[model samples]
Target chain A: MLSALPEAISILLSLEGILVLMLGTSLGIVLGAMPGIGSTVAVAIVLPFTLTMSQAPAVMLLLAVYAGSVYGGSIAAILINTPGTPQSAATCLDGYPMAKRGQAGLALGWATVASVCGGLVSAVVLIFAAPQLAAFALEFGPIETFALILLGMTCIVSVSTGSLIKGLMAGMLGIFLSTVGGDPILGEMRFTFGNWQLFAGFNLLAVVIGVFALSEVFIRASAPISNVSELVTFSGIELPRWSMWRGRLRNLGKSVLIGNVIGVLPGTGAATAAFISYAEGRRSSPNRAGFGDGEPDGIVSSEAANNAVTGGALVPTMALGIPGDAITAVMLATLTLHGITPGPNLVQENPTLIAAIFAGFFIINLLLLPLGMALARVAAPVLRIREGFMMSAIVILCALGIYFVRGNPFDLLVMGCAGFIGFLLRRQGFPMAPLVIGMVLGPTLELTLRQGLILTDGNFLAFFTDSPIAFVLAIAALLALMIPIVRNFRTSKKD
Target chain B: MPPTITKLKQESVIVQLLLLITAIALYLSTFKQGFTDAEAAQSPMFFPRIILMLWIVLNIIGLIQSVRHSNVTNPIASWWRILLVIAVTCVYVNLIGSEGFFLPSMVFALICLPLFGIRNGVLIVLFAVAVPGVLVLLFNHMLGMPLPTSRFTHYF
Candidate 1:
């Protein structure tokens, strides 16, 4: 893996690579700065375009968007008092206060610098940690992999907001949906019901766009458009002075550490990391007294932690082939579409591609400082666009993107149904992340479980009894599922 | 709370139950489709059957819990507006195939902008033409990927 860096750097240095990194990052920031378009939706919006790209560039484009959007969210949080993504919600606590106090430029500067540092550090962590983890995961048999995936799915569903039972149901429904195309082992159709389109099952991209992007449009449409107004005026980002780091270096380090740790954990995401880091900063920072009242430390804590999560979330997905959330799931799906299977052997098989991804991710984070400053001016006018036109535009892009992916109109139908259903379910407080994760992980989970069962001669107990790794993972899966429920029950009892 | 909020609240439970029933029916269909020996670990039905059964059970549990402790809140948007958007979007999807991408999208925008609260006629028309045109240019013209087009004009 270390040896692949030269080739990877060469790929990143190419004209096409440079163009993709710059443009993709710029698009991500613009979309992420938009009030309603979050990172997941931003990635989904660009997903269609990547289909025409090659293996490395396609993945690189998405990675650029993912990293850029996470940072771009802080712009909205500081200037407009709106967190573009939920992860940036923590940024609002200090970002908005700073903006209101006439430090909007400085606030954005702190966010940009902190976000870049955190992202760079996380990318370094990814480069170093992913290889080791993948090397370790090489020992994972089908049973152990199955156990890890179970843990991954349950952890995500459990960590998700809203009703646990509903999250589980959504997860199950997603897994069931993945089963529709064909039975992996028997080669028999399970749920297609003789429809030829059902042979390939549901298009994951269509469902992703529908549930994440189109449904978001539907949600916005359903809501009253009262905020179709001008956002806070912002010229561009102002870089914080070098000497300003004075007493805040500790907070920055701690927040980045918190972000990386939370990011590596399955199901826990950037939003959780940011909030946790913010609270930690409030407790431990030297500037604790000024925590939320336009404190630069507050912005640093939230922005650094959330941006750091971009790399942290990729750890499990790259090493174990299990996506932690919807965004990563979409990435894994893209890799699969590019003829690259993402699992433990992924690094061993395609060292150059993996190294290029890691290197490109680093470049994307570095681009944040310069590109963000340049793009902030452009985003202000965009933010002024009316909600009606914006929503209509998203719908059009989603429809066109989905249609062109396979040039199949049926995908549009699937997208429509998924959007409507997703809207209704979201209204009822179901999180869509678990559903997407479930669908992405479902096929692998099934394949591994059946293969493990066959290896054990149909004795399910042997799956755990034979492999210690599988045993540990299975126990972790159980604990992940039960701990949340137990905590909720205890809280309710107190109430 | 308004009666309409209460009604949407009731509809949530209905959605939950409807989801539960649909899941069970699907599971029953799975049994009929010859993955019935789900007890055999190697059978194709083994994994999906587990997921479906678990889903059904979870749905029932959620339904009971929801009915017992409802925390429904009214969203600012009206249900009628949501339904209207869905209706228009469905029409747009059908029209893309029949009338091609450009015309149906223009029509969709012209109708939807006002429905979405755009009051100005000129702004509506301007947007109705420009938005779809830009999208077509991005996908069809710039990328050299052809979008569905009517015989009258190929570029759009």
Candidate 2:
């Protein structure tokens, strides 16, 4: 591992790789700052361009996009009060208020600083800790994998902001939608309704864009047209005074740690990390009363956690080739397209590439401060547009973007249907994130489980007995399910 | 709160009905198809069946929860606007293959701008036409992804 660093650094130092990183990060920031267009769409849209590039630069470009996009989301969340990506929803609580109070620059400043800090910290952990973590993860087998997926599903409770039931409904609907494609284990088909395009599952990007972007347009269309306020000009962007930083230092550190832990968990992703971190920050802060009312700590905790997830998520992806979330899933697909498989053997086979990727991660984090600051200043004006017109344009862009992916009418149809369903679900208070997660993970989970069963020869006890790692994972799943139930009960009793 | 509760109860009942219908449909579909790999411990139907069972349970729980907690803050959007959006989308989807990308998207945008209370006809027309045309040029021409051109191409 120590010897591999030099080779990796050499590969990343290439001019082409640096150019790709800069270009990808810039494009990602722009795309991600647009509500409904997240890293998945950015990655998918850029995939065609990468086809002609060398493998190392191609992967680096996508990685830069993934990292930059996650941080870029806070820009819109802070300025417009609309999260550009779902992961930035936590940032909106205090971010938008800060902007509204004529402190948009300060909010942007803190977000940028926190994002860089989080990204750098996570990258450090990824560099030194991933191989060790991967070694432990190798012990996981089919049962453990199944348990992990189940634990991920349990996160639906936390993500369902308003109604858990509605969230579960949305998730169930997503699972059902996922089942529409060719059978995961067998060559059989289900729910294709005679359409050949249904042989492949619904494109996750189309579904995400439809749900977040197009559905948002429909929802906004009914509201009174409200123009975004004029961009607020600050005399100077101010950081938290040292005294204030000292006050919230412990909370910030805790949130960063929580974010990293959540990021390492498969399927939970940055949004969940940010949500949990913000919630925890609120729970533990001395001035909890200041939450959702322009508190800088809110920005710090949420931004730190969300950005830290960029590094934490890369751990499992690099080690096992399993994506920790939608963006990473796209990155994995992009890597596969480039004929570079990421797995346990990645470091051994291509040390230079891995090192280059890590070095790129470090550079992107360093670049985040200046790039994010400049972009935030520019975005302030654009964020103040009329909500209705902006939403309409967003819907148009989403439709066109989906159409551009494969030039398939079927994909557009899927987007349309998904938008309608998403609108309905949102109106009924259903959380859309769970649905997206389920849709993205469903196929992989189903296929893997079926294959595992095939290997077990129909032995009913094999899942529990085949491996101790699987048993431990089963226990973990049980605990995850029980924790929420217990917490809900305790809260009810306290109320 | 009481009125909100009653409305939520009604919604839950509707959701329950939908869940029941979906369960029956899925169960029937499962019967229509036999398991291809019987030797496998978990077949293709396994996860779907689990999901169906979970949905049924969740819907039941949802109904109970709705009854127990009645205070609800309904969204501001009217049903008419929602239906209008859905109907427009359906029409747009149908029209795209026939009319091509430019016309249908422009028409869709024009139709939608009014739904958002944009009364200025010129601005609506400008937005309706310009956005889609730019997208077509950027994605179809620049990016090399061919979009539907016109009725002549459809006939071919």
Interface RMSD of each: 1.6, 2.5
**Pairs that clash in candidate 2:** none
What is the lDDT for B131 in model 1? 84
* Predicted model with the maximum TM-score: 1
Q: If scored against the real structure, what TM-score would every candidate get?
A: 0.97, 0.81
DockQ values per model:
0.70, 0.48
**What alpha-carbon RMSD in Å does predicted model 2 have with respect to the real structure?**
4.7
lDDT of 1 by residue, A255-325 (tens): 99999998888778888899999999999999999987989999999999999999998998898887866
CA error at residue A280 for candidate 1, angstroms = 1.2
Docking class of 1: medium
Model 2 lDDT per residue over A1-495, tens place: 667777666767767766887777776777677666666666655654565678778888887887888888888888777787888999999988998899887888888778888999888878877777656665566656665555556655555667767777777877777888777656677767677888887876667667766676666655555555444454434565566576787777887888788887766789889999999989998767899998988998899999999989888778766566667766765666566766666776777777778778988888888777666655555555445466567656666566655767777788888777676667667777778757655665676577667767756468778777767767876776676678878988999
